[model samples]
Target chain A: MNAIVTVLRKEVRDTLRDRRAVLSSLAGALFGPALFAVFMNFTVERTIDEGEAAIEIPVVNAADAPNLVGYLGQHLIEAKEAAFDSREELRASVRRGETEVGLVIDKQFGTALGEGKAARVWIVADRANASAQTAVARVRGALRSYSSLVGVLRLQLRGVDPGVARPLAILNDDVSTPSGRSVLLLGAFTYFLLFACFLGGLHVAVDSTAGERERGSLEPLLTLPVSRGALVAGKFAATAFFMAVALIIGIAAFAVAVDYLPLAEVSMDADLGLVECAMAFAVLVPIAVLGAGLLNAVTAFTKSFKEAQSYSGIAMLLPTLPILLIILNPMQPTISMMLVPSLSQHLLITSIVKAESIDPLYFAVSATSTVAIGALFGLLAVWRYRSEKLLV
Target chain B: MIEAEGLTKRFGDVVAMDDVSFRADDGRVTGLVGPNGAGKSTTLRVLCTVIKADSGRARVDGVDVAARPLDVRRQIGALPHLSGLYPNLSARENIAYYAEMQGMPRREAGRATRTVIDRLGIGDLSDRRAKGFSHGQSIRVALARALVHRPQTVILDEPTNGLDVVATRALRDVILDLRRDGRCVLFSSHVMQEVAMLCDELLIISEGRVAISGTPDEILRETGCGDLEDAFVAAISSERESK
Candidate 1:
C-alpha cells in the first residue's frame, strides 16, 4: 500500500532522527553478548590457572567445629586460611564487594551433633556471580563429608558398628535433558532480543502518532480524504520495519554471546551456522508485526504525548515476560506451546545453541500466530480511527 | 452543499444532539459558533468523516456520509482545531504526505505544495520541521495541507483556537479565497467576532442541536443585535430560556 510505504518512511525517518535510541538499543543487546565474550574468555583462563593451583578461601570460626575446617584442605597441595569473626560480618564483606565468598559455621554445630541432630553452615556470597556460587558448593560438599565421618567415628566410640549406622546412606544423581543444556543461555539471548524489539520500534511509533499529536500536526493528516485504515496501515508497517532492524542487531548480539557460553561439562554442541542465524531472524517477523501494530494502537488512542507513553509502558513489559519466566525456572523447550510470545523464539534458539534440529512446523506456526495477533490488533486500531470520540 | 435530517448523537441516555437538522449552500463560509462542550466540534468531525452520528442522514453534495464515507471524504477537507503535520518530516513533506493520501500524483502534489507554500507565504520555511515551528507557522502549514488537494468542501473545528492577529487574518483570507473559488467552507469557532467577520452564513449550535441558521445579516436583524456575535449570545440565551 502507498500508505504503508509512507508509514514505513515515517518510521525509518524517526529512527534516523534520534541518536540515543540507536545507542540504548545496541547497549541492551550488545552489553550481554560482549560482556559474556570477555567474561567467559577471562574466566576460562583464570579458572584453568586456579584448577592447577591450591587456592585460599576465608572461613568464619565457630567454637568446636575443628573437623569441618580440616575437610576443606584434603584435595589441595597447600592451604592458606583466613579468619572472619562472624557469619554476618562475612556476608557484609561479600555485599560490599570485598571478597567473592565467606564460609561460616554456626556456634551450635558441635552441640547439635553431640545430641544427634543436623548441624548447618552457611555460604555467604554474592548470588549474581556464578563462579562464587560454584565454589561455595564445593566447600559445602567437603564439609558435609567431614561431618558424616565424625558422626560415624562417634558411633564407633560408643561401641555401635559403623556399618549398621550407615544403613540408609543415599546417593543423588542429577537427571536432566541434554537438549536444554543452555536454557539460561536461551533466556539471556531472549532478553536481548526483547530489548531490541522495544527500542527499535519505540521511536517510530511514538513519533508517528503521539509526536504528531504533541506538535499539533495531527489535524492536517486526518482532514485529508484518506481512510483512517490507510493511515494506520502506513504507521503500523513503518513501525514494524524499524522493529525488525532492531531485531537484527539483537540477533547479532545473541550470536556473539552464544559463541562464548562455557556450556561446562554438558557436551552441548557449538554448531550454530549462518543458516540457523537466518532462520532465527525469520521467526522474529511475526513478533515484529505485533510490536508495530500494538504500538500504533496504543499511541493513537492516547490523548497526548505523555499519555501515549504511559499506554506504551504495557508494551515495555510484554516482551520481557518470556525472558523473566525462563530466567527464574529451568525451562524445557517445546514446539507445541508456541502461543507464549517470545518463548517460542527462545525454543528455536536453544536448538541453535545445542545444534539440535529445529522443527519446521513449529516455527511456521509461531510466525503465523504472531502475524495473526498483529492483524487482530491492526483491525482494532483501524476501528478506533473511525471513532468520533477518539480523534477529538 | 451540505444537508442533514434529524441528526442525533447520544452518549448513553444523554442526547447531545436530538433531532437537529440544517442545510447550507455553496460558495460561502458558514460559521458554526458555540461555547465549549456545545457539540460544535462533534458536528464538524462527523462531516469530516472523522466520526459517525448514532442516528441520522447526513450528506455532502448528496453523498451519504455514513454509507460512502470514503467518497464523501474525497470531497471534503478539514482542520479540526489542531495542526496535523508529521513532526519529523519537513513542512513540504507533511503537505506532500496529505496530498499523496488524497491520491494526488507526485508531480501534482509537488505543484500544489509549491503553490500553497507560496500562496500561504511559507515558501522559505517549507523545508523546516513542523515540530518546532511557531503557532502561526504551523497554522499556515495546516491551511496549506488542507487546501492542497482542492476539495469541494472545507470544515474546520476552531481553527483559530490559538493564533495571533497576523495568523488569524491570513486564515480569514484563505477561507475567503475558498469561497471565492465556489467551494463550501464550514468552520466552528468560540471567537464570535472572528466568525462574524469571516463567515457570510451562520449556524448557532447549543447542546448539539442547531438553534439558529441564517445569514449574518438575517441573524443580526432577527436577534436585534448590532453584529453577529451579539446575535449569537442573544440566540443562545433565548434557546436556553425557552428550554
Candidate 2:
C-alpha cells in the first residue's frame, strides 16, 4: 500500500507538471458549460423575438376579399398589395425569395359567394422556407375564422340556432414543469461531464504505461523490489484521482454557466444549484474510477505510446454511446438501467437536473457495479504487469 | 554470489540461451563477453529475474529466482544496456525512488541516495534533471540508482557500450569499488579490452552456449594464445568447429 502511494504520488506529480495534459483535460470542463450557456441564451432570445414578430403576406388582389383581409389585419398579418400581371409572377416572386408568402383571390369569388357556391382562395408559399410556412399557417387560420363568422351570420338570418353547429368542447391541461422540459438540455451537460471523467486520466494512463515502455523505464521499474500489484494500484489510484478532479470541475462549471441563463422565460429550468452539483459528483465518482482503470488496463497491453494513445482515443468514445442513445431516443429511467454504469450515472444526472429525488438503491447499485468493473480491469493490469512478456 | 545452472531459454524456435551455466563469487567482478547476438544480454536478464529461464535454477545470495523473484530482486541491482533514466526527474530523485521501491523508508532512502551520489562523485550533478545530463552523467545516475538499495549482487548489461575513454574509466572505478565493498558484480560486454582490464573472471558465450570460462590469464594459457583477444577468437572458433 505504501509503495502504491509512492508510485501514485510520482505519477500525479509527473502528469500535473505537464502543461499540455492539464490544459487539454480542463478544456472539456470549461468549454462544455460555456457552450451550454450560449445555446440556452440563443434559444431564450429567439423564443421571445418570435412571439413579438409580425408576419407579412403579399396579396395579389386586395379589393376582392376585404373581409378576409380585415380578419388578417386584426391578427397583425399585414396584407401588402402586390401588382403582378400573371399568377405565375406571384409564385415566381415567392420562389425567388422576394416574398415569404403570397395570396391570390379568385376573380369569381364574389359571384360564387353571392350564388351560395364555394369560392376558391389560394395561399402561395415556399414550404421549404420556415418563415413562409409560418406565414401560410397564419393566413389559413384567418381565412377559416372569416368563413366561420359568415356561416354563423347566415344561420342566424335563416332563423336557426347557430349553437347547433357546435358539438363538443376540448381542453388541454399540461402537467410538465419547466425543469421537466429541460432534460434534453441537461442531458447534453451530463454527456460532457461523463466525457470529462473518461478523458481526464487518458494522458497519464498512456504516459505511465506505454510511455514508460517506450522510454525503457518499464524494465527498470519492474525490477525494483515492489510488487507488480502495488505499482499498478498506485497508477490506477492516480489516474482515477485525476478523473474525479475533472468531473468535479466540469460539474462546477456547468452549475455556474447554467445558473447564469434566464431559462424561466422559456418555461425551462436547469436549476443547477449547489446540492444538485454535489449529488451529480457523488453519483459519477465510481464511473470516473471505472474509466481510469479500463483505460490503464488497455494501455498496458499496447507496445508503444502512440499505439496506446490511439487505443485510448477510441475508448474515450464509450461514454458518448449511452448519451447519444438517450438523446436520439429518450426513455424513462428504470431500475434496470442502474445496473449499467454509464447509463446509470446518466440517469442519475438527469434526475438531479430535473430536481427529482432518485432512489437510494439506484445509487448503491451504480457505485457497486462500476467499482466492481474497475477492480476487474485493475486486476487484469496487475496480471499483465507481472508477466515476463511485460518487459517486451 | 551469483549462480546459474543449465539455464535454457527459447523464443519460439530460436534458442536465446542453451544450457548456459556460470558462477561469480563475492568480492570479484565477472565479465560476460560475447559477440552480438550471443545471448549475453539474455543471460543477464535471466539472472536479474526480469525474465525466467525455461529450464534452469538460478540464485542470488542463495535465494532461487523463480521461487522467490521479489526476494531475488531485492538482492540484485540490475542495469540494462540503456540507462533508462527518467528525463524529468533529478538524479537524486531517481535514485531515491528506486531506494523506496526496495522497501526503504523515505528518510532512509534519502540517506542512501545521498551516500551513493557522493560515492560516485556525482554530488555536483545530482540535483540536475537528467534531460540535460551528458551520456556519462546519465550513466553515473543509473549506477547510483542501481546501488542505492545496497543489493548483494549487481548485474549490468553492456554498461560501457557507449562510454568514451574517460566515462569508461569512471565506470570501471565504480565496479571496482563495488568489489572492494564485497558485492558480486556481473556485467556483459563485447569489448574484449574492457573485459580484460576489469574482470577478475570471464564467461565467453557464442551461439547461445558458453565457449570459455576462466580468468583472462588462464584463458590465454589454456587456449595457447598470446593475448586475451586472440584467446577469445580461438575459443569461439574452436567451439564452432566442434559443433
Candidate 3:
C-alpha cells in the first residue's frame, strides 16, 4: 500500500509534466458539458422563439378564400397573398424555406361553398420541413374549425339540433412531469458523463504503461522489489484519482452550463444542482475505477505509445454501448440491470435526473458489482504486469 | 556476494544463456567480458529477476532468485541494459522514486537522493529534466537510482558502453568506491581495456557460456596471450573450436 502511494505520486508527477496530457485531459472534462449546453440552449431557444411567432400561410388566390382567410386570421395565423409565376414556382418557394406553406384554391371553390357542396383546397408544403409541418397543422386546424361551424349552421337551417351531430365528447389527460419526459436527454447526459470518466485516465494510463515500455523504462521499474500487484494497484489508484477529478470537473461544468440553458422554455425541468452533481460523482466512482483498470490492462499489452493510443481509442467507445442498447431496446430498469457496471451507472444517473428516488438495494448492488468487476480488471492488470512477456 | 549456477535461458530455438555460472565476491569488482550476443545482458536480466531463467538457480546474498526473487531484489541494485529514466522528471525525482519504491519513506528517500546526487557530482544536472540530459548525465541518473538503496550487491549491464573517457573514469571510480564499501560489484563490458583496468576478477563469456573465469593476469597466463584482449580472443576461440 505504501508502495502503491509512492507509485501513484510518481505517475501523477510524470504525467502532469506532459503538457499534451494535461491539456487533453482538461479538454475531455469540458467536452461533454460544453456541447450539451450549446445544444440545449440552441434547441430550447429556437423552440420557444418558433412557438411565439405567428404562423404564416400563403394563399395563391386570396379572393376565393376570403372567409377561410378571415377564420385563419382570427386564429392568430397570418394569411397572406402569395405571388408566383406558376404552381411549380410556388412549390419551389415553400421548399426553399421562403414560405412555410402554400394554399391553392380551385377556381370553382366559391361556387362549391355557395351550393353547400365540398370545396377543394390543396395544402402545399414539404412534410419533412419542421416549420412547414407546424404551419400546415395550423392551417388544417383553422380549416377544420371553419368546416365545423358551417356544418352547425347548416344543421340549424335544416331544423335539427346541432348538439345531436356529436353524441360523445372526448378529452385526454396527460400526467407526465417535465422531468419524466426528459429521460432521453438525461440518459444522453449520463452517457457523456460516464464517457468522460473513462477518457480522463486514458492518456495517463497509457503513458505510465506502454509509454514507459516504449521509452525503455518498464524493465527497470519491474526489477524493483515492489510486487507486481502493488505496482498495478498504484497505477490504478493514480488513474482512478485523475479520472474522478476529471469527472467531477465535467459534472461541475455541466451543472454551471445547464444553469444558463432555457430548459424551462421547452418544459424540461432538469436543473443539475450541487446535490445532483454530488450524486453523479458518488455513483460514477466505481466506473471511474473500472475505466482506469480497463485502460491500464489494455495498454499494458501494447508495445508502444501509438499502439496503446489506438487501443484506448477503441476502448473509449465501450461506455456508449450500453446507452445505445438502452435506446434501441428501451426497457424499464430491473434489479438485474443494476448488476452490470456501466449499464447500472447509466440507469442510476438517468433515474437521478428524473428526480426519482432509487432503491438503495439497487444502488448497493450496482455500486458493489461495478467495483467488484473493476477490482477484477485491476487484478488482471496485475497479472499482466507480473508476466515475463511484459519485460519483452 | 552474488552467484549463479547452471543458468540457461532460451528465446525460441536460440539459446541466450546456456548453463552459465559465475560468482562475484563482496569487496571486489567482477567484470563480465564478452563479444556481442554473448548473453551478458540475458545473464544480468535473470540475476535482476526481471526475466526468469528456464533452468537454473541464482542467488544474491544466499537468497534464491527464483524462489525468493523479491528477497533477491531487495538485496541487489541492478542497472539493466537500458538506461530507463523518466524523461519528464528531474534526475533527483527519478532517483528518489526508486528509493521510495525500495520502501523508504519520502523524507528518507529525499535524503538518500541528496546523498546520491552529491556522491555522483550531478548536483548541476540533478534538478533538470532528463529529456535534455547528455548520455553521461542520463547514465549517471540511472546509476544513482540503482545505488540509492545501498543494496548488498550491485549489477550493471554495459555501464560504460557509450561513455566518454571522463565519464568512464568516473564510473570506474564509483565501482572502486562500492568495492571499498564492501559491496559486491558485477558489471559487464565489451571494452577489453576497461575490463582489464577495473576487474579484480573476470568472466569471459562466449556463445552463452563462460569461456574463462579468473583474474585478468591469470587468464593472460593461461592463454599465453600478450594482454587481456589476446587472452579474451584466445579463450573464446578455444571454446568455439571445442564446441
Candidate 2 Cα outliers beyond 4 Å, as residue runs: A55-57, A63-76, A80-87, A97-99, A105-121, A130-163
What is the C-alpha lDDT profile of model 1 across A30-73, one tens digit per residue? Answer: 66667666765575566665555555667776445766666666
How much does candidate 3 score in TM-score? Answer: 0.96
Clashing pairs in 1: A7-A234, A8-A238, A216-B83, A217-B83, A217-B84, A217-B85, A218-B83, A218-B84, A219-B84, A220-B84
Evaluate candidate 3 and give its CAPRI docking class based on DockQ: high
Judged by DockQ cut-offs, the docking class of candidate 1 is acceptable
DockQ of 2: 0.70
Q: Per-residue CA lDDT of candidate 2, range A5-27, in tens? A: 88998888778778889998898
lDDT of 2 at B55: 99
Q: Model 3 off-target regions past 4 Å?
A: A85-88, A95-100, A157-159
lDDT of 2 at A15: 84
Give interface RMSD (Å), model 2: 1.1
- DockQ of all candidates, in order? 0.41, 0.70, 0.87
Whole-model Cα lDDT of every candidate shown, in order: 0.75, 0.86, 0.87
Off by over 4 Å in 1: A19-24, A31-46, A56-76, A79-186, A206-220, A257-273, A297-304, A319-335
Give a tens-digit lDDT track for model 3, residues B50-157: 989999889888998899888888889988777989999999999999999998999999999999999989999988999999888888889999999999899999
User: lDDT tens digits, residues B71-134, model 1?
Assistant: 8878887786777666567899878877877877778888988988988889877999876888
